[model samples]
Target: MYYKYPNGDEIYNVMAVYEAHEVYGIPRINDDEGLELRYFSLDEPIEELNPFTEYYLRKAGYINKW
Candidate 1:
């Protein structure tokens, strides 16, 4: 899955989708994707994600205000 940032930068392979709390279970791979990633807490529900992640999550059928 490919997605674009708000600045119009494009990213290839949006990677895997997992439940928010399950994120830690995901393996840490090399920086092959070249993305600068940061962890956010879905438990908070009030936190907002970057546009690209939000868009990808929505397209993947994950619905949340953030």
Candidate 2:
């Protein structure tokens, strides 16, 4: 999926959804930056989303609006 920032930047292939209230994936940055499994909630808005998680949720049809 695509991740968008409030500053108008974007990153792609950074996420995937497999179940309710959770998202599973990692941002594909430089290999030196490494990777890890990150989580996001669909049950409620997250205050520290970097703004991208919500955008993904909405774009993927998991949410209608913020």
Candidate 3:
């Protein structure tokens, strides 16, 4: 996932999001008519994140640091 720098020109990946998908899970809605819906929310409850998670803080490292 990537965030826009207000102007929508700058974009970058946010590892926390990727990790959340692997760890917790993302809500998915499946349709039988050859259509699939995958829902993703960036608003994560603070408690959902690992306390030891230092991605938001580290800034330098957002991958597995969380």
The number of the candidate with the highest lDDT is 2
lDDT of 3 at 17: 35
- Candidate order, lDDT descending: 2, 1, 3
Can you rank all candidates by TM-score, best first? Answer: 2, 1, 3
State the weakest 10-residue window (summed lDDT) of model 2: 20-29
Q: Count backbone clashes in candidate 3.
A: 0
lDDT of 1 at 21: 57
Q: Which candidate number would show the highest TM-score if scored against the true structure? A: 2
| Position 22, candidate 2: lDDT | 41
Better of 1 and 3 by TM-score: 1
lDDT of 3 by residue, 1-66 (tens): 455676668665534335344545655656666454343334433445544444553454443322
The reply for model 3, stretches above 4 Å from the true place, is 14-53, 56-66
Q: Which stretches of candidate 1 lie over 4 Å from their true place?
A: 1-16, 20-46, 64-66
Candidate 1's C-alpha lDDT? 0.62
lDDT of model 2 at position 37: 41
> What's the TM-score of every candidate structure?
0.33, 0.38, 0.19
lDDT of 2 by residue, 1-66 (tens): 676999999987656567644434663556766565445555667666656667777878886645
Encode model 1's per-residue lDDT on 1-66: one tens digit a residue: 576899999978645655655455545558797565556554354255566667776777574555
Clashing pairs counted in every model: 0, 0, 0
